[model samples]
Target: MNDKNDLERLRIQIRGAVQGVGFRPFVYRLATNLGMVGWIKNSAEGVWIEIEGTRSQLDLFLLKLEQEKPVHSLIQQLQASSLVPLDESDFEIYPSVSGEKTTIVLPDLATCSDCIRELFDPNNPRYRYPFINCTHCGPRFSIINALPYDRPNTSMNAFQMCDRCRTEYENPLDRRFHAQPIACPECGPRLEWWDHHGKRLASDEAALQAAIQAIQNGQIIAVKGLGGFHFMVDARNSDAISTLRQRKHRPDKPCAVMYPSLAAVQKDCELSDLEAQLLTASEAPIVLLRRKANISVLERVAPNNAYLGVLLPYTPLHHLLLSALNFPIVATSGNLSNEPICIDEREAIQRLSGIADAFLVHNRPIVRAVDDSIVRVIADREMILRRSRGYAPLPIALSKPVPTCLAVGGHLKNTIALTIDSNLFVSQHIGDLENQATLKAFKQAIDTFEQLYEVHPDLIACDDHPDYLSTQYAQHRSSKFPSSQIFPVQHHHAHIAACMAENGLEETVLGVAWDGTGYGLDGTIWGGEFFLANLTDFQRVGHFKPFRLPGGEKAIREPRRAAIAVLYELWGEAAFDRTDLTPVQAFNAQERDILQAMLQKELNTPWTSSAGRLFDAISALLNLVQISTFEGQAAMALEFALEHISTDEFYPSVIHQGIFDWSTMVEEIIADIEQKTSGAMVSAKFHNTMVEVILQFARQWKQKRVVLSGGCFQNRYFSDRTIARLQAEGFQPYWHRHIPPNDGGIAVGQAIIAASQLLKRGG
Candidate 1:
């Protein structure tokens, strides 16, 4: 009570996810209630608070601060120091400091329950509001242009709140208080429709209804969403799904579905508890749910797979659109084959003109493009396939902080990572950067992440592939930071490192990295590799035997060539004369002759140790797939066929020099085909043989831990069975949890490895 005579002041610095997630508002409320006089502001460093009050009040304020932080905010540091008292009357919230470099950026969040309730409430002013949002929901990472997230720094700056919203913004009791994206029906963006010819429709609602009707009548429509655009069609309409498949040039890859609600998703597929939780999480990623047998959805949507990727509406516009459309819709990316998604309206019309019958779009600009996030529930935990939308810009916390660094990811499924101070932020999916548009998108995304996080990286890291566009970009950026070192990490090593980082492993583990292709350290293509790796160093222990990649990358698009190579290695010229072989019409005479010559002379052919190529070889050997329209179509088809086979007995195989004699597996396949063994039986035997061989390898090492990585892990049948079998043997098996098991997570591994190297050097 005698504080007036002997006043004490305190300055506090709070860091770690204390910005752009209602941290300031919580502070304001706490300070006001505690009868403390101080001002809180957001700086480039973190949240800054100065309090001048009685020691007891200050103690109470600090006590409540940590215990009562905002639901999503994580307070990593809270330091307080006494200072001279500044006699102030009331506490206040100050404007954020600008031009201060930092590494903090917010993650995009799914629509909150309150926003959903308000969207459907007929009496609410924001009823049917396409952009209804508050501090707890809506765009954060995607829309932000700068840090210290304020309205003016986002795309929301264009829309001014009405008087009522302004009152709510000033009222601490209101949920919308200081909400940056606060908008109403009158002030926010609205949906509009356009025909395939780019002509504007007369009525937005009527045009959308007409589009829905067309989808019901077997036509495809391109629908714009918060991040980018999606090409949607009726999931149950086989003709519509087939038409979309043909138009998008996607022959075998599965398309995701946008169900009307959670209940609707449950009606079509069986959901585990974890699947249900992830489906309803704030991220709202598309969850791969196992389909109930004999479901009525069109076969073209997922082909032979037992699971379907399903998602609930994450945006207000999506909710409204789905509420009017009664059936599930095939929601896929709106783009041409092998291209990035179209974000601009003009780009959408120009790029998607041939595929979409109509376009449902909006006027709000997407400052940065983001793809929809994809996930699957494995072993009762969420495994991300494509981490974007609600997941991007959210820094993955590291066990140890490192100097600022940037990691340029691989050529395919490109994504970049930036680390400043202790936090690391990974960009959204940038697609394959082989094309100009995707490369431009990659550059833009990098610039966006750097700007928003205020990061000026002191070092740059890239893949060892000299031909990769990501490598070129890193080289170009290196000039700007002359003092910054550029570290080139091998692609497969990065893959193992990524898994190690996600699991927080400190010791060496045997990493089995399997994929399609990566430039190996030995100047060959390496995909099936076994390495004893930690964050700092790795030693190659074993790998698949090398086979000539006939015609290089061309062999990947045509599985028959891979078949010829595998057969040639096993049976020479007699490989083609095998009576069980079926001549597929897809490979013309000239193509066959060239492949034969290439295999014989090994002309212009590079060798690769790739498990994906082995899968391709099996697909062609069985005449299951002659051509692959997507990257992993042949492999997926093979997995599907394998699912039908029974695993009652193990197929015989020989292991020589740590390499499983795959020739024996091929011989067994040929023998099975000649004997007219059931396709299911052959497939089951094949899957079992591969699993047995991998287990045998593990047995040889007796390694306590196994790290499974690479794009191949996306296969649920293989990953699940492998992990289960290994766990039964009392070994701890680790897979990517926070990020993808594919190349999308390579940057994470690169960062972890680079940080470890730097720490060792410093020590």
Candidate 2:
């Protein structure tokens, strides 16, 4: 036995992503195995533990704790100190205690391999069970209603565990120990099949089989998922997909396909080692991969796109269903176009009745809806195009701490951000705020985050645009919190700031923000812009030449309008007679006359330097897309057309007085079109010219670090080439990886900028 002088007590406080991840059990087992006596308990802040042992024993305990923690647990902060021995006899786990909140909710995880094996094993009690989960995996953020991450605070509280399951839960050696969503078929949620008319058709196994049969018959089945619902249909069923497109009012956007396994995905798509790892990762996000040759059967799913968004089975139900079938299924969000995804069965039925023939739903209520995350490999790195579901509500580490703040993101692709200490919590994709349903969902998401984090913001940040729904909401909320300060950030600045924040850059960098549109500080529309910026402030250094957008917002939906506007700006009224131009031929004399008048009188014409509008104009001139059916349709088409084509040749362009004048490039493109040049060559030349413009500016500015942001960077071809060129030219280049390059990342930028400014003011 060790002497009393050799014994010591240690008190440890650990924070960040510790709860509901089997952390306490892991600690209990470690302490007991080391012949130590201690008590561990969950707390509002994190986990608190006290252990008494010899000095060497305590040292070994700390070492093992650091070396062999749970897979999903992240120890952001840990403090251990010497204390007087409490004379404890045995290791024990005490109940959780209440305190000031500091911890964050972990993102919902995809089902784990252990659970999957148990699900399919013949002798396992949960064999073929759809709701099987253990401590290492399953839902956390979606079903959670409050903090401290216990079963009573989650939707699982509605179902008390069976005696057998309870014994496993209480056993520290078992994998299901303290797993909040732990359940078997006899004690957990069950699936049901319902008709579009709210009539129940089948339950449990029958329901799963019925959904599969309906899918094989080329019928749309709305399946409730971990975070929300998905509309599942056979990817090869062209007629069924066409019907879904027609009913959902989504004609051109590509749908994600869920294959049975990674090997299955490799057969149809070109998958790299990294891509395969990402596909099978715990997040299980939809990864855009290049399609292999001779895969025409899936053409209806992705249309003319060169890449197919693919995902593996993430949930047990998905696995059970896919394993029983040979064909892949198209899994798209279950909602009408432009609306938030539905989480409730009744809501899914009411919103998707006309589209879905049957509904496969469960009784475990999702506290909030989260759409699937979308990712792609650009510049040999993973870029998250849409952050949700398996990748959201997880805090982004910040470099510094500031006053509590809430950032209301832009109108399109809205997502709010909340700050606690040095962690930034960016919400999932909230979609466009045009409809009441989306707007209401946006508010509810904010409310849920605020409640979950217990954050009463002392400041609010929003886009400077006066009329944007997000800005208006910020203003409206400021009245409710009279003590809260409101800070309106410029739109393009937020884009750049978001990039800087994502990269943890505090120093000035060349910020290249190119997107479809943003409200400029000069009362114009800015999209293509360059700024010398840091987190707190920015200086506008360069931008594209301004051009008129005829009919304002209407021009965005009609590429022909932007095409005509560019042509008119070049040759004035003389250009209208050029019937050889596709945009000119598409518009009749009356429409041309009206457009000319709008440009001349400046009525309802907004001047913009948007790179996205420029791409739209070029697409129209190429006769590829004269009208857009979706937000990024024309631009995506432009990117698709230039996929494999390469050309070092660039068109003529000039930079004078911080303005990139592409008039000569436009003239050259028109000449190439008149000369019957290939569309690929023209697109290559245009892309080359744009890359050269940024390069020339970077050389002139003498900035070694360049940050690229905005929606234009989402084009993989452009981003990959630009990054390669920048690195070859001996410059550090940074683009978004975790956050989106679009407006979905605006809140993160706003939050960081606001926090930086507040720190400067000593707030």
Candidate 3:
């Protein structure tokens, strides 16, 4: 040691995601390994580090700290200053700062490999335990009540840790080191069983086994998960599936299946390399895999679809239950139709009383309700259909940080986003906030996100629809915070912005946004639209031709009515003269007369340029679906009917001045019907024509990037073929990756657009 003056004590202030994601333990390990004397503790501001060591050793420690941090941790700032040396003997980690107000919060993590191994290992103490988890895995965001990420700040505070768990939590070498939710079978939450009538069954392992037996016997069981409850039934039982459909009022929307393992999934569907990887990834999202030929799943599970939405068990509870069952289970959300998922046990019993035959209840309370995420493989890349569960609260990295803001999403598939500093926390899927229950859930989620992330928005952003609940909520909040700016973004523009943000594109591009309906700037229903847009600015350059919706909102529920409207637009009065139409035959004489008169008088009819309407028309034309039980049932059935068609020849409607010649398409479709073309062939031809039209537009704007978004892109046939054709033509085509292409992603897009607008205004 040359000089004693060289020895110094330095205090470092570290910030930016330096909490909750094993950052403290990482620091402890690093400091101990560096042979430096330091005491590190987490404060509300950030990690506080005081080190007294030789200058060279401190330099090496700093270098290693930057290079060797935890995989998920982000160190944004590291401030170091010299202090008087105390000559501490060893490095130690102090308890987290008490009662501190911290801005940083951690996301909930999927179960880690180490925990998974323990769950499966026969020799491990936690073998096959339904509640086994450690620091790197299990619940964080959902159980959390306040910041600093300690057990007392979570729902887990009610359960005192046993001595063994406390010892393991204190040991840095143990996987449970500092795990707030650490628990064992003896000390953690236990499962209980209940009948449909809210009467408690036997509270033992036999109860769980009996619950599994009931599911195998084709009974619907409501099982509580980490975030919410799920209704489970045997996948092979058609009667049970139909019963669930009728009870949930979800007749045609595909229900996801939970398989026991990946090996089981391989038997039912053809999984690609990426599909398999995504299935095995920590975020075990439901992967829409191509189904095997003649696989005998209940027809009601994926009515009229070639692919099945499948997911492997993500949680220990699911694993244990599925293993006991030894078969695929139809695991759909436990809720009434169009309602938010039930999280509280009392609420679940009250709401799902008539839907499920039994209940697999748990003692642990779920502070948040998160639905299972759904995804599909398009062009060899994973595309999110729904973003929830393992994905939410994990902030999507922005190209550039923005000021604090809150984004209230669209009327349907609603979710809210809050941006604080550099992190943006999105709420879980909030369903349609059109009803009282969903609206209440939306408000609760918003409050929870703000409290957890410690953010108060300086600006509020919402969809342009004045009547939407989300918009009204934003308006109310803005009125309360009079100084905060409020901005309304066009719905389709938000769709394109979401796509652009996901792909990290900055330049202007061609955006094709298609969906069911959105309140257009011109006050007409806009769905099929083409826009020239970037982050802030968007111009509508193209759209589908407008036609009268015979009964307005009634037409959406009845596809045959939309078909009659299309027929009237195409063949005029001669449409009723056709004797071969089954839809016409299905209508009684009085009903037919009323329909014709309504079309002629245009009573309560609204004009729409919606691609979703075209799908309804095709569905009714094929006689495949006359009345849609769900929102997009007719379109989904139409897509299913197209599975038999070849992609050899494409006949697309001409585009003039950026508008699709839908009148000509309708005439061509009528001609095909007159020629006695099979419904299957016509459906295939219609799908191919749409793909051709999209490709044509991409070729026209070859210089600009092509972004595919909106709920319509959820149709795999159109999205897959369109992407392939565009890539073949040597044009760059981008689709959604992390966020959903549907309205679920609209909140993030709204936030980005709002931030850009604020920057433009120099706010």
Candidate 4:
């Protein structure tokens, strides 16, 4: 009815999270239903579409495009331009074009609801298919090796699709249309069970049955998942869990448990609405929830912890396995302590042979390793404890644009980040860089990020710690990329910058960066610090009083040594004669004399203002934990020891010349111990004292915006109370949500600070 002159053409370019999310097929269906002639194709930049129709039709298409986008698709930027109409009869999906990559790679999603329904339906052709996936779900970053996100670029390229799957993929009306990982049991990758000795046991359905039986038999099974392998064992089998702990060399650190259903989770642990929502969300992460009373089966699983990390099964295979068992299972990372998770089958078998009794693996190769993410609710908001699996390679939007850079994170809880335009891409949790294997994994993660995004950084950022392996790697990389400048960021400053960057704050703010240890610019170990910081720079304002760490790094693993050091600082050499103190009683007279000599001679003793060591000292003084088996054990024990007491009471402390001295509080605690005061009351008073110190500092500062960062903020009780107090005092306090407060998030901070410095230099 309309004249040909009324026809118009529009060429649209869509960027950000558009590919691998059915954007092309969605566009094709929209165009066909509207009776328009056009073509859509995938490009390195994103999706490109050209359509010709009446002006009204084109206008309607554009409106619907924004209104009815796919659930997983995030359209960050869209540009449309007028183009000459080509009189085509039907719409088409062209092959993807290759160029300099600029598109964002979507994180691997949990199985979708539609897929879950199809998985359990008896009549569905893809019933019980572990690889069953549609455009809405399944693997993304884990299986992707190259850009454009086409089938040829994924691990599924090895297995050719059958006729039915091909038909569904080519049909614009089907949900599986353009689904890169779509396949059926007839042609998809199959599961295989193998013994620890590399002998084949079973295949397909029998393989799943074999795994289930092994778990029932109290044997450890290394199961391959979407991101990496996991060591699954019956949670109720205390002996089996103990064996796993001994074998995995993880003695005291808690393991995550995967429950059969939400009902089962609620039965074992208390769950709030927000926690429940996170468990069932697409990015299913292990959430730390307070355990219900008398859950005896989980006693050995979490040990002395007050909370348990629980998650619902996210994959079809997990659902199938859990459905058969109808119970909870310990699903910890499939790697040894302080190492990256195993991704390849051979690698998993090699690394986990001693720990796993059997293997539940498949042919689908995992291109990169991604551990399950861990989170907890703090200040009524979800705070990430570990960022991996469901949440890696996703860019955190920056407030302003800067030059490309790579940030090699701190020594412990290592993670890396790279900047492209205004987006900062933080890598998954790459374990501690202690041994060669972990260091290799760290480098590989950086390489993977660079290859996937095609980013050659113009700047490199690293912690100021000269002895840290991450800093050394940054120096080595600088040698290779001679044109790139290397920037060594101060540790606490980087922590504050990372929190500020994620919150999109560009203005100056008062930053409270407290952790166990960091390399201070003053050539000392600094952790408890206050700073006036922005994204570009920071100035150290106040800090905790310095104390000598006897036996240097040995004091970290042995809290009694820290306690002895504190006593020595307060009472000098005569402090060792206090035989009634728990720390003195824990060590013999000979050992006490040796420690006193070490302190007096300054032999391997380093001056530190570390807040973490202070917590260790307090825990040791309370006789809660003398020798830590894992990182943050003493601090965690301190937090868990709090009883229902008065929140308003706090020990007396004073600040002199910007030094928030803990001497007065320690003296009060000693007096309380002499008076036979309860440990809970003393612990509560100590926590309240720290809060009071923070409040006093906030009152003195003119800045209203307070940014909390570093590992100390991981304590939910501390953070929640701090945020509440700050809010009550008419101050705005911001903490991490998507990123962790530990060293795992320092890379993000490093990247932002490096970028800001480079921009200031007009790079």
TM-score of each: 0.93, 0.98, 0.93, 0.98
- Judged by whole-model lDDT over C-alpha atoms, candidate 4 comes out at 0.90
- The clash tally of candidate 2 reads 0
- Mind giving the per-residue lDDT tens digits that candidate 4 earns over 538-639? 989899999999888889999998899899999999889998999889999889889989999999999999988999999999998999889999999889
User: Candidate 2: deviation at residue 646, Å?
Assistant: 2.2
Q: What digit string (tens of lDDT, one per residue) describes model 2 on residues 1-763?
A: 7677788999999988899789999999999999999899998789999999998999999999989999888899899888998777899989888777778787888899999998999999999999999998899989888888888989999999999999999888889999999899889999999999879999999999999899999999999999999999999888999999999999888999999888788889999889998898888999999999886346878877889999999999999999987778999999999999999999888899999999999999999999999999999889999999888988888877777889999999899998889889999889998999999999998998888777778699999999999999999888887987999999989998898888889899999999998999999999999999998989999999999999999999999998988888888888788988999998888888898889899999999999989999999999889988888888888888887787789898799999998888999999999899988889888888888888988988889999999999999878887888889999899999999999999999999899899998887
- Lowest lDDT sum, 10 consecutive residues, model 2, at 295-304
User: Candidate 2 local accuracy as lDDT?
Assistant: 0.90
TM match of model 4 to true structure: 0.98
lDDT on C-alpha atoms for all candidate structures: 0.81, 0.90, 0.82, 0.90
lDDT, candidate 4, at 125 = 98
Name the lDDT value of residue 318 in candidate 1.
79
Runs with alpha carbons beyond 4 Å of true place in candidate 3: 1-19, 43-87, 98-107, 120-123, 582-586, 699-703
Clashing pairs in 2: none
User: Which residue pairs come into collision in candidate 4?
Assistant: none
lDDT of 3 by residue, 126-199 (tens): 77677788877788777889877788889999998888888998887676888888888778887789888778
Clashes of each: 0, 0, 0, 0
